[model samples]
Target chain A: MDSIEIPKRIETINSFKAQGGKVAAVLPIHYSRALFRAFDILPVEVWGPPEVEASYGGVHLQAYVCSIVHNALSFLKKGGLEIADFILVPHACDSLQGLGSILLDFVKPTQTVAPLYLPRGKRTEDKQFLADEFRALARQLSNLTGKEPGDDKLLECIEREEQADLLLADLYRNRTGLGLDNLSFYRLIRSREYLPAEQFTELAQTALEKHSARNPNGIPILLSGIVPERMEVLKAIEELGGFVVADDFACCGRRLYPKGNERDPFLRMAERIINAPPDPTRGNSIDERAEFLINLAQTYGAKGVIFYELKFCEPELFDLPNLRNSLKQAGLNSVHIEVDIKDPLSNQVITRIGAFLEILE
Target chain B: MDKIVALGIDVGSTTVKMVGVNASGDFEWNYLEGSDPRVEDQVDSFLQRFRTETGMTDSVPLVATGYGRKLVGQAEKIVTEITCHAKGVFKQLGHGGTLIDIGGQDSKVIIIGEEGQVVDFAMNDKCAAGTGRFLENTAGRLRVPLDQMGEVAIAARDEVAISSTCTVFAESEIISLIAHGVKVEPILKGLHRSLIIRVVAMVRSIGLIPPLMLSGGVVKNPAIRKMIEEESGEPVILPEQPQLMGAYGAALIAQKIAVG
Candidate 1:
């Protein structure tokens, strides 16, 4: 297969804008991309974008805020998010909740703010609460777009996202035989952050069809974290004889949603998200996350787990101790590497990963 | 030397180390020098010295390990310090156990399995508090020679509390202590205590494995060795030429390729 041509985020954003479609700037982790599409709005995720001078955002936020919020607020103040017609800040964690509050109550940017409250746990009530939250967001989106999309139209959009997610999951299932490098694979995976469901479906299908056959090398490992800010870490893992067989990153793998079973579109969307991989931000219990990860390791033949997280990410930091202990009990070794977004991957990070790979070896 | 067949180079942040091993995996010869900014040239010059001193025309496989290992363009393989140290110590000591390597800039706790595999490991964060630099920084303030710090510190029965874990701040804290007329010996002992406490925190995190082993440049410091033993209540084991373990391990890894 020829080198896969992935869509660039800037060009995609420009093309969508040129079509007179409004863009909703999405913040980390879970949100209703399908609902955004119901109002003909494109959802573009913001994950720090790395290397932004966070001075402006720093002025407003505490020194301890995670770089994602710091750089995001700074990026907004710097007008980097001017292309966004609305900013959708989901209450993924306390820091994100604070970001939403700050945007709505103060430092209000030109873009309209849409805050979505995420429910904790996998209880039936949690699903109902989230579904209700989605319905509320849809109403807000309706007011912003000045056109309330019917339930049927919303369901249609939800089905489109479900299809895209299925393909994404399939691409992961076929990752090893796909023979793509770590960087290329992640690039394709993250393309969903901005690409439309149809476009993402097309890209994912192209990748799956173009799967080249090759014997994959390196010790298979699972990655769990808030985000992979420093790309060099992945390269280090590869060069040091480690292969990422699967991941549980908030920006990538954790969002892999199975199909939902509900008559209402909002409930369906909520169910899909709640049933997706257990995430630290989602307030899933340590047991749930550990079981999911152990299963992931068993399914993928991964020998170890590497928790590659950005510093000051409270949600990830909270469950790490229990999660690591649980993994060790299951006979799957793990390592936790925390890093700052502004700095490049350090030798310390590389050494820890290299050593962990050696442990697996 | 039974004909040196493999070479290992550890281009560390503070020093460059090279080791040669024979067919039977016995260390044949070694070289050490301060780490220079131009690593490629330094390595090239070291290789030239090896050829002239050993007077061996046979080519040997070279494995490089260190933070600067990537700069060793001529190396057949680049391994990390953790693996290299574990291999070097396990090969020399002939058993698997917990190994603590306190280098100038980085500190590591590696649990070696019974078969010489790295079972688990943890390195110091970006902070220098748990490393040799932390001691050197504060020792410089107290006017203690790096070599004699351990001796002076170990002898002081009444040790002051060195509360600052930050290397730079420890200096400021030292200055404040000096102004308060605190005894130098007690303060020096406290500084050593502080460093050991930081390392012990890491050891506690992974849980201590018995027959605790020591390597790296700081292993030469007796106070650190004795204090670590005291902190963990486990006897410390030392390999010959602890400073050269990384390079020695690299050489041992290279032996496989040479024999193949």
Candidate 2:
């Protein structure tokens, strides 16, 4: 199969601008459809980067501060982000609030603050308060855009997005059953950004439809890693006759959205994404990562699991001790792969992964 | 007479320290700064040193402490640094002493009762804010030897306050201060004070009390000690070579086990 070439989105941004598209960029992860599509008029997120030279960490904040926020700020310092006409800042985490404040100071975007006030529902009035808040936010957006989004348009957009999501959810479901090989698994994750949500959904569905026709005679392997920036490493695993059917990485499998209740899609989507399995420990706390692998091995008839740890990523390193212990105790066939993103395309790592999978089978 | 001995080794990222205490609460021997790489190999060497240094190696029970305690061979008991440090501090200060231990890679503030048991503790393992690593980094940036930072900090006529909370940022801030004609003395003083503030925050989180016993290698720096006292509003009880306190505590635990 030939590799798919991703069209440059920069040219598309110009067309989007000419079409008077409202652009906004998302914060932290900065991976959002609304923000990306709003190319000309709005940037999804705006936040000041942390001073990298600061060694002690924030004196006021706890040491367990998320490094992702720091990375976002670092990228901003390097002018890596696209400028937006407006941005929506949400109080997602403590760092997000700090990033919002920093973004407000520097980015000079038409700032729209999204305060996620999760109500405990202790009192009936609290639930009412939340509903009122949500309505107010919608009203605020409507006022800012100067286009009162009718119920029909909103519902239509929701349905379209939901369809895309259902296809994605189906991909996850199929992968869960067939046990994706490490290489193909990572390739699929990388394939997501290259195609639009709808197109990606179609591709996934097509792939699943043809899964039975495709060769499944490979060693079943669980591909685990901290955010794998490069897709080739996963492909190398596939080339070695090992199929990665399961994973625990946050940047890939876990980040994909599954279909949610359309009656209240946005809120349900947010809830599902929030409730999605985070890494079991600090860093990538896939609490059920080991369990997921074991279950997949039993269900998909996997022979081994390959755990990938990124270099200098302490959170993953700390989790590995317990993860390795659990896998050993479970008597699950597994191998640990430590990957340094700096040496991403290393043949040495590929050879090791191949040898381990070969031995297990 | 046959002698009983128990060994306690604390393997830190930068250094390996071990102490052996006999059944009678006597210091049989002590070994510090073993070979790098696998610490299990170092333990074997330490055991050999125990016999060479003290001329007695008859069935000494071993208890391991610190991060690499589990990796050490045949540790009869594996205890956490929090427990060991608390026990060592308790034996020295005898209860109601807040322990401030700033080691190579991490910093910890432990509050203990009279029994030397940990009541509450807070640690900064993720960042080098309050740890010795911060000072090491800051000294390197300042081009001042770490051993000299203590004296330099103490000599400052006016302290140059640094606002950056991060140690990496603090070094640049220190350099900029120097470029702006700030005296080295005050800048160093400020740096030490910044570290003290970070540790003090952890101490406050764990709850502060009087008669603080400062432990860990960072205690070797008197300037840091003074700043900790000034910031904490209570003088720290100086343990002799506080870096050895954790090892000493492990030794004490070994002694208790051997005697029993």
Candidate 3:
């Protein structure tokens, strides 16, 4: 999987664009990739760059906005996304929504923008609302790409995604059994964020076949966070004799698509979103998220949990106290560390993580 | 004079603290000095001074803590100040409770469990407000000594409202208040109150336990301890030599390693 570098993925997208293919930039968290895949639009997920000297993002956005949004705004200001024909900002959180507005009003005023409204509840009305939103988004995409994808195309894309999801589930389920360390596993899985679905599935399948018996060397810990932007956290855990057996990061673990019963493509997409893992931003109760985290920890045989929250992320911060209390009541020791996307890892963070591991030991 | 069984060094933002502990983990000799820019050289000199004063060999187990802990190359183990403070306070107080350590650049409210373990903790985020530096910066502008500022704050009959929690903005606010003929005592009281309120919020965020404990260099200020007590409705427990708790805890950890 390491052989498929990011440069190659960028080149693939650039070459597709060069040949007159439309590119759409999407923010992280839940988004229907089937719509873009069916329309032949290349979807690129925007996780913030590791290091950025903010130009307009800090000046325009609120000082407290998470670095992910800031860096995305910075990327747009610097014309990094000029190649993107349009931008799709999902209704994931307030910051991204605000970023979407800024992009449309000021930065990249000429670029077409779509804001996805994801459903937060399981009611029938919620499902209908999401289905309508998906239809609207499909129309918007069709207008942009000059192709209205049929139900057959949507179903085919869904099947490809379902296959990828199942492969990902299998990979996560046997993660400890796979000899790959934490960083390597995340690097491989996170590639799906940018790489084309079919290409990602091929890589995932190839990696799955090479799985061996469980290594089980260090203490197993569960990681919950907004995103694994701080790849250094994974590296530090591995270096400090800890293995991340499971995770519930928004961009990693919780974003897994659930298999749905509906045969209609739009309805199935809505059901998948409604039935997916509990998300803090989607108004899921802390009890549900906490139970999900605890269950993941228990199933993966994790000794403790690490809550690596992005600093100033209101949704995650609001959910933290209740989540920590719930974990403690369930007799699981957890540590909370605030992360900045710009400086994902620092000596201070390393020391704190080292001490947290010592406590668990 | 007892033979040193372990050594601990805490290279903090404001000051460097080192402690030598006996086999029983009791502080036998200690050193404290303002932190120099060259941390490695400062650490090497401290080690030399310890050896010269106590005639201890270089084989003593050493642990490092605080912000500059990584700079100490001689340390056998490096731990965060959160863990070390909890260990040091719990060992001294002989109970598990909430420990709030307001350092030069940051403040932390840590919840310690029954086993002297850090159950949970929260630190001031990338800001100088509610820290020793906050008062130090404003005190410099007010032409008040750091030690005398607390006493003056305690002597105020009435408090002025300080809206800004930022250290830089608060300095400006203080200047404005002085121009408006606000007494220095009331303004000083307001500053202390503001810092305490910030610290108390952190304590509540971690769910403050009973028997709240205070450490770090800021604890030497009488007004901070008093205001924190008044605001939280809990008497603050102070460790002997509060600023050295991180090093003391590191020394205890070192002693444990040496014994093991």
Interface RMSD per candidate (angstroms): 1.3, 17.9, 2.0
Here the TM-score of candidate 3's chain B is: 0.98
Residue by residue across A1-361, what tens digits does model 2's lDDT show? 2232333445534555677765544452312342232222333332223224222223323344454455455554455454444445544445656666666665433446444443332244543444455455566566567766554554555455457656665665576443455455445544554334555566666666655434555676666655554457767676767666656565555555544453553454344344444443312343466676567567666667777765444556667657765776787755556543433365445544644653454
Ten residues in sequence with the least summed lDDT for candidate 3 chain B: B118-127
Q: In model 2, how large is the Cα lDDT of residue B135?
A: 85
RMSD per candidate (Å) reads 1.9, 13.0, 2.4
Docking tier of model 3: it is: medium
lDDT of 3 by residue, B1-260 (tens): 88789999999999999998989888899999999989889989999999888887768999999999878988999888888999888888889999999999888888898999988777874789868999999999899999999999998999998999789999999999999998899999999999999999888877888989999999888998999999999998899989999999999999999988
Q: State which candidate, 1 or 2, has the greater TM-score.
A: 1
DockQ each: 0.68, 0.02, 0.49
Question: Candidate 2, chain A: TM-score?
Answer: 0.66
**lDDT score, candidate 3:** 0.86
List, residue by residue over A1-361, the lDDT tens digit for candidate 1: 4346888988999999899899999998899899999898999999997878888898779989999999999999999999999999999988889999999999988888988899888899999999999988888888888988888998899999999999999989998978787777888898999999999999889889887878678999999998877776777788889889899999989999998879799899999999888887778899999999999999999999999988888888888888899999999999988888878777778878877887777
Ranked by TM-score from best down, the candidates are 1, 3, 2
RMSD of 3: 2.4
lDDT of 3 at A192: 80
Superior candidate under DockQ, 1 versus 2: 1
Best-matching candidate per lDDT: 1
